[model samples]
Structure formats: structure tokens, C-alpha cells
Target chain A: MSTLRTEEMTLNMGPQHPSTHGVLRFIVRADGEVMREAIPDVGYLHRSIEKIAEKVGYHGFMPYTDRVDYVCAMFTNQGWGMASEKLANIQVPKRGEYCRAIATEFNRLASHLLSVGTMGMDIGAMTPFTHAIREREMINDLIEELCGARLTFNYMRIGGVAWDLPPGWREKALAYLDHFEPILDEYNALISYNKIYIERLANVGIISADEAVNYNLVGPNLRGSGIKWDIRKDLPYSVYSEFDFDVPVGKGEWGKLGDAMDRYMVRIRELKESVKILRQALKQIPAGPVLAKVPRNFKPPAGECQIRVESARGDMGWYAVSDGTGYPWRVHVRTGSFAAMGIIQKLSQGLMIADLVTLIASLDVIAPEIDR
Target chain B: MEAARIYQRIKDRFGEHVLEISDHQPDPFIVIDPASIEEVGSFMRSDPELALDCLSNESGVDYKDRIEVVYHLFSYSKRHGAVLKVKLPRENPTVATLENIWKSANWMEREIFDLLGVIFEGHSDLRRILMPEDWPGFPLRKDFVEPTEYHGISTVRESPIIRLDPKKK
Candidate 1:
């Protein structure tokens, strides 16, 4: 006279599913809809970029950085370039610095756009996602026009930018900015304040300031948890400090600011700030040589130097250990998304199946950054 | 908040175990004995003045004669940072784990184990992260030799032969 009962079911999210982003698999043990344990399985997209870097010369390795964080290509470009500059002790020209700032800020906007748009799609709003990519198309066009590639724009050279700003580029960029800000307002009205979106995101994935700092979370994920830390502002590599912009933090004003909502809000706010910075950069850019005077084949003196830059996701660090050779002895990338992904296991625990998509999307965990 | 004062405090506490402290061009970094890493790391994180609560990056380097474990620690409150290095002989490069101090060290230690073949003495799950579980050698080490084939499949280094049609040829 015993009744039969079902044990907890095991579910596999993806090694190729759309919601999992790129080649990421999660094994979840759940009782009903509530997740018991979510174990992330990576390495599906491992390219051995570090090993490849050891084989190529310093300049030749720039393209590999492009493949690592495919979404935020400029950040990767800057990370690798800045690391080489630090190790080589090369000085960039003023015009080169201005262009770097403009390109990096544009990349940040594009990355944040994808994150916000994809997160919206993950949470069941398709229209906002479409609108986001429509804006991102303009960014891709600009990047392609500048670097001859859309996604992997290896436009940053060690001494400076690969090329000068094209004619009428400033006017085109300013016009895009004018058009883009209104779309952001529409995005906020459509997704950020939507009752359904807020309900799914608010207080869903909560990481306190203590835990955030302890885990070394960077970018918007760290800002979302109410910590005011941005390498661009704090370290001020390049001319980021010269320009006036805001580092938006998650105040939990809309739907527990430190949760998924805060993460979304921070990106939206940053999009506006990036626009502001781009406008300033376009207006003030001077006409001069973009490339600094360096040897045709450059080699840094034997030493190790670490360069940390704020990527769209978090603090992207490149530690270059040189041996006075064209190739680096060792180059390690401390990606922001890799650090943010650690919190996923903790955040996803005890949340429902539907909430998992929202949580992962909220963190904006890019897979190549995790696997690389 | 000068870098020297922070190095001085660490030197005062650790004594001769602090091998070398210098303010290099990029930042202030210290090299210490591999055996003393855990104790020194705990002190640096807990000290109110240093308060380097955040473990920014933890990585391993494979020099010719020895292996080095580098930890980048930062203090959010103080807006200061320091690099802690522990060098161990190549023959037996095992260092005490810092997972007790900062939880973020968990995966980073595993990665070092996978790449450089350096073992963290007390890591809960020290296994291959980037490479396959059954993969032979530590990929990042200088001594590593890439295999031409694994289980009959050609490796990435092998060039595929393109068969041209007789007419085209």
C-alpha cells in the first residue's frame, strides 16, 4: 500500500542551444522547476589562443585577440595592444590616443547593445532584440569601414591605431549618435520598464557587494551589485580620464537595482554614456599622424607587465611576459566574462527553469571569453 | 598609499620569506618562497591597511628551471593593488592553495594545474579545465611536445591534402 514518487529530473540545457549562447552546456538537477545544481561545462570553443600567441610575433598575435571576445573586438584589440605598449614602453601620439578612445567606446556600445538586446530576447521580448541589432548594424558598418572586417577588427597596432579616421567619418558617427539615443529611450520604455521583464529580472539573481568583490567581478556585473569600480575611470588607461562620461551603478531603483534589472539598467545607462563620449571624441579629434615612430619589427625588452582594461563585460587583463623577442614568452588574458560566469552556479541555484535564461542573460556571459 | 609603505608592511610581517620587493614600471610586485605563499596571502588579505580582499587574477608561469604562481590582489576600499609571486622548483612545483582566502582562486588554481602541471596542495577539485581529461602533457610548459595525432585523428598542425581532379591537374 505504497504510493510511487518521482525523483528529481536531470536536464541538459545545451552544447549548441540558442539560450546557452555559444557552445556552452549546463547540467542541471532539478526538483520540479527549481534548480538544485547547475554545473557549467566549457571548452567546446577552445582555440588555444595562448599557445598560438607564443608562436606568432607580437604584431601577428593581434588577430587572435579579435577571435577571443568576438562581440567586443575593440576591447580585445586594446587589451593586447596596451599590454605590448606597457612591455615595450612605447608612447602613443595624441591623435592616436583620441582614435583609440573613440574606437574602444564604440566597441563598448556595440557589446552592451548585444548584451541588452540578447538578454531581452532571452527573457521573451523579440522586438527589442531586433531593434538592438538594427542599431548594432550601424556599428558593424563603421567597424568594417575602418578595419576591413566586421567582427574581428584588428584595428589597433601596438604604437597606435591601424589607420586614420576616414573622411566624413566624424559626421557619420555624430549622426548615428543622434539617431541611436532615441532608440535607447524606446528600449527603456519597451524592455526595462515592462512589467513582465521587471518581474522576471528584479531580485532574481542577487549578489551582494561583498560577494561581488570577493569574486573579482568586473564591468556591468560588478557595477550591477552596487560597487563603483571601473578600470577605465580608476586606472584611466589611454585618454579615458580626459573625456567626461558617467559610470552608472545599479541603484536598485527599478526592481532591486542589484539584480538582473540593475545589470540591464547599467548597460542601458552606459550605452548613453558611450554615445556622449563618442560625440565629444568626434568633435575634438585633431589632425595628426596616428602611428608613432617605432621600429618596423618591434620587440619589447625582457620583462613582465600587466595591463588591465575595462571591457564591455568586466576587467579584461593581459599579462605579457616578454623575453626581448618578437614573440611573447607568455601572454595571459584575464577576461571579465570568465570571472562573471563563476557567479552563475551560485545564482542559478534554487531558481526556476524559466528564471535560468533570465539569470544567464542578465550576467551576459559570452562563451568564447569563458572558454578562451 | 605609496607602494613602498605597503611593501614595507609585508616585509615587516613576513621577514626573509619576502624574497624581493620592487616597484617595477607597471606596478609594485613581490616575489616570495612557494612554501610561504598561503600564510603571506592570508595576512595581505586580512590586514586592515592592505585589505587586498579581491583576488583579481591568479596564474602560473613556467620558466626554464622553475614554475611561478602569480596572484594579483586588489583592495576596492583603498583603490590599491599588489602582485604576489611564488617561485617553486620545476622538479616538484606544488604550492599551498589560497582557496581558503578567496573563493575565486578555485578555478584559477585548476587552470594552472591543467596548463603548467603545478599542483595546488589542497585544491578540492584539481583537474583538467581547458584540455581534455585524458590529454597527455601540460600544454603551456616549455617542455610540452604537441602530438601529431590523437586516436587516429589528425591534430591541428597536420595539413589536409586537397585532391584535385585529373582535368584540373
Candidate 2:
């Protein structure tokens, strides 16, 4: 049979589409099933968050950071807190640091559950998402008890957390982890190794380690590319160094290294690590006042610093500049999802239309983070 | 591979291009000439001793008189990082693009351009990434004023609590 010449087509995905994750829009130039390029047109969710930081003083800005990435708000909260603390040279009490870590790890667990559960739902597996959310709901209850808010828990303050773990909350969190760990194994058997899911994700959207580094991919995305770097383990921010937990990297067991499945597996394995860290943190949390003696009208000296937190998405960088005043001169957040979105145009070339969803889900690009 | 050593290496390699270095600050930053940014960036990334492979964070801050572009460089192999800043004229803040040296600089440069109005010369696709194409001014700039409306939609809303108060009326 003679070959047929097909015309190129331009298609728009999202700005409203569910699979685009949040308010992201992509302009895809495709020749049949293979995409020539998927140019991402972001900013639909731009709330001028960094600008808001300037308007709100250092202490008041804690709640605004929660909206930066609501899925993983703790890291944003912690990143802002750490940056301000570093700028002001304030030492968080040891007990306050442990509380921050405890609340943060639980937030990590909740964020990853939503990510993987949605990964399954985006790829046509509905049952796994419900199962994942069911587990996530328990985590929400635990976090809600700790901070009072479920989605946007503004838990961390500049020097420390808003409050200590509530009475009997430590035991409740430990019990939840004990119940949550087995569900992870059952989740793996249900969706992770399924033949169809593997075929959809394993070999698609492969990002080599060099490209991953060049693009500055952080957290699980960087580890999924087999770089073996995690800001928490390597840099030891907050109370992370005192805890005993292992960092997981993608092994490329099923397909090519740095493929979609590699990223997915990295998140799944990190969930276990979060559990391990939570177990250690709950048992070793020191007793003292969680809130430090920060003045009501706080002002740091004139200086600027960038602090990196290994958030659920990856490494979230908070670049805060203070001009020896009540208001911050400038604040910029360098987010993982922002960098991940940058590489999509290059990765989308020659990828199948359906596989585009797989690539995005695997990367776990949250829209608010990108637009912020 | 401490940050000061990394700064000293760059200072030695490009003496005239290095403008100033402040060690007193909590996080020391070396200011580089806007013209020689690409060269300094290339040297930092390729130099074996200062193998700063990743452009981890890039942001722009408007200081009213001048605009500053900050690049947070990290070395995964050497396990060290350095902060580089470029000061440009406030009127037309233009600097050489480091996108070619570091692929991650591509979107970050675009973001700086969009929010702070810094021009990255030779950037392949220098378009707004966060704001609308027709957005009036750089929202992050210190002198910027939020427009009253955009495309006929009001940007601000009256406080409902104030509106509902009978005593105020």
C-alpha cells in the first residue's frame, strides 16, 4: 500500500480540561497521533502570590504561602518560615523543629497519595484513586487535628509551628501510619504493577539524568531520573537530619531509566519513607513550647537568602529579600512544577496524544505552583 | 567547594567582569557585570573544580533605581552552590541570557522578563509566562500599579462585611 500524507493539526488542551491538572493550557501541534510539540501556555491561575508577600508582613504572610501549592502547603509554609528564620538569624526551639517536621511529613503523605491516586484516575483506573483518597482522608483527619485546616493548613510560623501536637495526637498519628503502610502495599498490587498501567507509563516520556539536571528537576522527579539527590537528606534542613529515613531513587526495573513509571515508582517508594520518618518523629518529639518568642511586629535585617525545602513535589526554593523593614522587599518562589512545565514542550515532541496525559501525571505538575 | 571558593574562582577567571562581593551578609552573593553574565555562567558550569551544573533558582528584584537578576547555581557532583547577581539599568534593564549555558534558565528568564520587566538578550522565546499577553505592567515591580480593570473585569472587590454593615450606611 502507498503511504498517505497527513496534515498537521493544532489542538488545545486545558485551561479547563481535567487532565491538565489545574488551570493549565497547552497548544499541541500534532501530526496524527504523534505530537510535534506541546507548547504550554500557563498563567491562567496567576494570583500574583509573590507580590502579595510584599504587601503582607513576614509573620502575616504565613497563611498566604499555603495557597502556593495547596496540595503540598506544608513545604511552602516551611520554606517561607525557614527563609525568614535564616534572614533574621532566629533559632527554632528543638521541640518546635520536631513539630514542624511531623506536620510536614504527614502533609507529604497526603500530597503523594493525592498525586498517585490522581495518576491512576488520569490513566483510566478509577478504583485506585478512590482507594488512595480513602487513605488520604485519614491523613487529613490527623492533620486537621494538628492544625485545624484540612487543605491549606497554615501550620508553620516564622520561628516554628503555630501549636504543638494536640493531646493524644501523637498516638493517633502513629496508629494512622500503622494502618496506612499496609494499604500502600495493597495499592501497589492493585494499580502500580497492573499490565495496562505499566504499558501506559513505563516507557513513555523518558527524561535522561543529564536533561533532568540541566532542567533543574528536583525532589522525586530528580530522583526518578536516578540522580540520588534530596535536599532534606543532603542539606538537612529543619529537624530532618536527626530522623532516620532512606531516600528512594528510580531503579528502571520495568523499562528505561527516567521514564514515566520511574517517576511514579519514586513517589510510591517515598510514601514508605515518609511513613518511616513519621514513625521516628512521633516517638522522638521533644516537649516544649512550639511557638517561639517572635515579636508581634517582626522585621528582619536588610539581607536576602534562598532556602530549599524538599517538598512533596520536589525541591521548592524560597528566595526572600528583606530591606530592614516590616514588609519584604521581594519574594520569589522557584517551584518544581514550574521547571517540570518548562521541559514539556521538548518532551511532548513525538509523544502520542493519550501518552501526554501519562507524562503530565508522572511529572506531577501542580498549576498554582507554576503560575505563582 | 565552599561558596566563597566558588566566588574566588570566578573572580580570578573573569577579574574585570566581577563587580563586587559581600561576605558580611548571611548568604554572600557576587555581583557580575550584566554584559559578561553568559561568559561567567559558562565558566561556572564547565569548570571542573566549580562544577555548578544546575541553575536551581533564577529571580528578578526591582530595587527602584536598578533591577537585579539573581541566579542560584548548584553543583550536584561537587555538592556546593553559589549566588550570582546582575544589576541592570532601571530604564531598560537588559542583560545577556544564560539560557544557552543552563537549560533551566529558559523559563526562569521568561519569568523574570514577565514579572520584573528585565530584558534577557538573545532569549529564544522571550514572552510572558505568568501574566496575560496584554497585561499592562510588570506586577512584581516596585513602581507597578495594579490596573483598575482588565478586559472589562474589575480587579478589586468591595468588602462584603463593610457593604452589609447598617451602621456604616
TM-score top scorer: 2
Candidate 2 residue lDDT tens string, A1-372: 458667999999988998889999999999989999999999988888999999989988999999999998999999999999999999999999999888889889999999999999998999999999998898899889988999999999988989888889988988888888889999999999999989888889999999999999988889999999988899998889898888889888889999999999999999999999989988988878887888889999999998999999999999999999999999999999999999999999999999999999999999999997
Q: Supply the TM-score for candidate 1.
A: 0.96
Model 1, B43-105: lDDT tens per residue?
988999999999999888888988999898889899888888998889878999998899788
DockQ of 1: 0.69
* DockQ of every candidate: 0.69, 0.88
What is each candidate's fraction of native interface contacts (fnat)? Answer: 0.61, 0.94
What is the CAPRI rating of model 2's predicted complex? high
Over A116-172, each residue of candidate 1 has an lDDT whose tens digit, in order, gives 999988878899999889989999898777778889898999889999988888888
Query: How far in Å is the alpha carbon of B56 misplaced in model 2?
Result: 0.5
TM-score of chain B of each: 0.91, 0.95
Q: Quote model 2's iRMS.
A: 0.9
* Residue A292 of model 1, lDDT score: 86
